[model samples]
Target: MNPQQPIKVLLIDNHPLVLDGLKALLETYSHVEVVGTAGLARAGLEVALRTQPDVVLMDINMPQVNGIDAIELFQQQLPGIRVLMLSMHDSREYISTSVLRGARGYILKDVSTEEIVAAIEAVARGETYFSSGVSDVLMERKPDENATPLTIREQEVLRLLAAGQSNRDIGQALGISAATVETHRKNLKKKLGIATTAGLTRYVIEHGLN
Candidate 1:
């Protein structure tokens, strides 16, 4: 058989076992090549800079810096590289945060190897991918009443802000950073034209979003 063209990939996760398993699984795909692995976000960033992988599979709950943070950083540094989050948690906050932070795809760790490979390939082609369960959760929420409806991530950030969480707390809870939370807050305020905390609270209550 003629050799298939390989898609370069970088795997990032704090756990060695998870990284090893993912590397092995991805290698099974004829079109995928595991170029490198990193145990933390910073190391992953360096690897990405050097290897310029077609796709990066990132784990969300890593030490020091998480996948969401890495996505923003990597996108700014290497605009051409695609980041596909590989996470164990399917929480609304986690999935929404990754999407908002510029992740091209989100796949659960428990997904089959075939699905994971498909997700990586799809993302490398500049498409979005979500595991079946993650897609269901994302689709469960109906759009808000506002004519210019907020995205899933913006809505979640607004809800958390309305509940009196600080930016740092929101970041910690959502696996993002304080700067990202602040940026989302600014965008929400601009879009909704509601700047004050009281105003946001009132808006949420008026719209029955709470």
Candidate 2:
């Protein structure tokens, strides 16, 4: 494992197109070699055990045996192999869970190619990496070190919205303009990973914030 040597890598994603895209993207780097790929967690673990890649680029959500739960399986077969999660989820719960499950880094799918390369390289080198927004979510200080901390304004908006208030009414109640209210609405949605009012309401009730 020379520092200057090209990194050996494996990719595990359910989508064939995504695997192709990642292989093509990774091949462009002389320092990165795509040793193997698999569309299933079991197959990927098997390939990983055989290929002995330095890093495993894993997708979080697969049809069966999600990447988070599979991290330990991979470790059992390949103890020192680092895993970098390539997921669309930026929520604190997912990121925290992945880290707890032994992911070395987490980056969103929307990240740029440069970022993707950087994350792979960093994680392969035994360093942690997170996309900018993912880092923001992780850096947010929870109430007691594990609580998901939403902004004060976002909480206010979520409470009012869960109470069946319109955006206009919420804005009026919060002393902010409707436009500002809309901005807060979008931010909270992104942060909480809830897109609809119904989903938000469910979240409100589930968390006992109602």
Candidate 3:
């Protein structure tokens, strides 16, 4: 995240040609460094741990662990690293899920190299960056209307939980006990009809609760 340092990048894509092309293109920029590349999300996770890159350029479709699912892994294991999804699909589900799982940005494969570089830099700086097309697609989705509304206390817990805080962490931040935090978490899931942490996070994001 230091301005003087070059942004270290790791590329993860199933296609060899895509990896090669991205590496070749990104290497042309002096501000960016290609740290490593992987053909799978698990392999990419290993490389990311080892290299500790500033940003990760990950494709959504791959064998074993797909990129959308892999985002949570990166978030849990390497929370400091920014993940920028590079995918061909512009589906709303994919974009929403990527953000829910803690991806910093989502960009299509067909975007210009300049845009890709911009996204990496933005995410590395702790900012979100979606391509113009991706942003447009996300803007079209409407919030669920029939969902139960959350109380003020529930909203606080949900926001902290979505920010990746543990029960103890949320409790300390909100001046509540861990047990209370857990109860709030359970109530949140029930009220939202969401089962997983990621689901709750997506709900918080979609509803602008965070």
Candidate 4:
């Protein structure tokens, strides 16, 4: 492959070993260029802005600022740069947050090097990609899948509520205000057509929201 046409890539992860391993794996692809790497979200943001890479492989858990928050910030700063979340977490919350934050792809850290490279290439070409194991986490819930539509935040609140957390607890866990938690609860109830907390709990149980 011609060096002049290589696809530029930026990698961000808090772990040094993971960063080094990813660099090694990605370098084997002759058409890909590892433009830069960072171990913190702030440094990643700066590198991304300065390098303007075609794709970013971002880790979900980072010191100082998380990958989901960084994704939103990077999208605002560098519109059109594709973000591919690479993380050890396969939980719905992390996957959903990535999509909501404008990430074009999500892949597990354990995925094969070939899949990671494919994900980066696909995302850089304006296509969405998800690791085979994580695809279900990205599926948009059908309108009828629930009784009504829930905003992303409301769904997050609902999931936490179903885990038997108090409003104050949920607020602290989500970094939101207790009053905001109450508002979310009200909105969830209204949208789901539930009249009571018992009803909400039942809905959550039925849908496996927890």
**The best candidate in terms of TM-score:** 3
lDDT accuracy of residue 67 in candidate 4: 93
lDDT tens digits by residue: candidate 2, 1-210: 678888999999999999999999989989998999999999999998888898899998997899988888987787766999999999987876676556778899999988999998888767777898887775532223343678777888988776556789988999999899888888776777666654565455346564
Better of 1 and 2 by lDDT: 2
lDDT of 4 at 55: 91
Regions of model 2 farther than 4 Å from truth: 142-210
Q: What's the lDDT for residue 116 in model 3? A: 97
TM-score of each: 0.67, 0.66, 0.74, 0.66
Worst 10 residues of 3 by lDDT: 136-145
* Best model per lDDT: 3
TM-score of 2: 0.66
Alpha carbon lDDT at 106, candidate 4? 88
* Cα lDDT over the full model 1: 0.80
Give per-residue lDDT, candidate 2, residue 113. 84
Q: What number of clashing residue pairs does each candidate have, in the order they appear?
A: 0, 0, 0, 0
Candidate order by decreasing lDDT: 3, 2, 1, 4
Full-model lDDT for every candidate: 0.80, 0.81, 0.86, 0.79
Residue pairs in clash, model 1: none
Off by over 4 Å in 3: 140-155, 161-210
Single out the weakest 10-residue window by summed lDDT for candidate 2: 138-147
